[model samples]
Target: MDTTILIVDDSQFIVDGLAAILSRKGYSPIMAHGGDECLRILKSAIPDLILLDIMMEPMDGWETLEKIKGDPDTREIPVLMFSAKKITPAEAKEHSLSIDDFVSKPVNPAQLIESIQRIFSRRNDIKEELLLAEGKGVDPSLIKEYGALRKSIEVDRNLLVVLRSAVGRDQAGRTPSPDEMAAVRALEEKVASSERRIRELQELLARTAPPAGQQE
Candidate 1:
């Protein structure tokens, strides 16, 4: 299947040009006029990658990037910033934004293709590395620590969803039943305890796990 790409730009010209280039390269490009539209599109389905313009009105590229990266659901989607602004290596280093690559505006088709290919290549490399590590039998302490942390994160995410749903129900004059409220409270306590356990497991792993180059 062709990889889906979401293109966010204020300029129709740039959007059209990018869509044409991506289509020619065998990618499926979906266009959004601005950051709000981009987010609305994401509500239905996330694209494989995002090509974000940095100079849109109302919500510029940087702000949009921040919003995307801040949300856990969207943070993993690779973002390539398409910008006319010259970004110094030092400036890019200082920025906390998780931009995968930057493509200069008046986009060069060759460079864009190369950048996208590199991103996918790097992703494959990481996947291979993870598989290799798993196959080698990761340290038991490390596994325990990671498993605990993952569980805690899942619990926290669930808590957020429940809280949001409860608020929505309340606003709709259909507040949660007493049993549901009690269940939510119990879940909150469980999440807190799980978080504490995860922290302890992390500390134990730090103390017991072998340092680099050490054997079991």
Candidate 2:
């Protein structure tokens, strides 16, 4: 399963630009034109993440976010809010809502991608730490496991390169074939599963490790 992302905004340009960027990066991007459209799409399928724009005609991003957070089914999907309006930390805190990150308008592609990557990377780290905390002891075999995990990450990075290439080709006015899309999707799933496995191994290692105050 590719990491599916939903993009919500009234601007066709933004939706197309983001879709192109994510598609090239091996993520499957779905678009919704407005708050109503977004909600409607959510009724059918849930995305792994959402990129929401704050300004729009009729219902705005803030209102859409509230609705999403209010609904149990959609609430868990991480949202990265984007806006031309300046956002303050206090405003974000006052919302009492789930916002994984915030991005500014006239979106910087590099910054946007970096932010998303950071969010997922941190999530993987936290998951690994939690797994370790729950373990009885660190596994001596974990060193080997770690090596294998690193190899998997390397493979994923290679796949990302392929995705980037495909995106570059598409940007030159060439459309990607179904086979290319399938390949990208497979790579995305592989990366996600590898990360999960790595976290589990990390937990096992943590559980088996000797306490700091204990002798070897």
Clashes of each: 0, 7
Off by over 4 Å in 1: 88-91, 94-97, 139-216
Q: Per-residue alpha-carbon lDDT of model 2 for 101-204, expressed as tens digits?
A: 76778899898898688667755765575455445344436654665465446435543553546445336777767665566566667678879988887666
The number of the candidate with the highest TM-score is 1
Model 2: per-residue Cα lDDT at residue 32: 98
lDDT of 1 by residue, 57-145 (tens): 99988888888888888988988877776543233434323666666777999989997887677666555644444554566556545
The positional error of residue 87 in candidate 2, measured at the CA in angstroms, is 1.0
After best superposition, candidate 1 residue 167: deviation in angstroms?
49
Tell me the TM-score of model 2: 0.61
Worst window of 10 by summed lDDT in candidate 2:
88-97
* Model 2 ranges off by over 4 Å: 136-216
Native-to-model Cα distance after best TM-score fit, residue 99 in candidate 2, in Å? 0.4
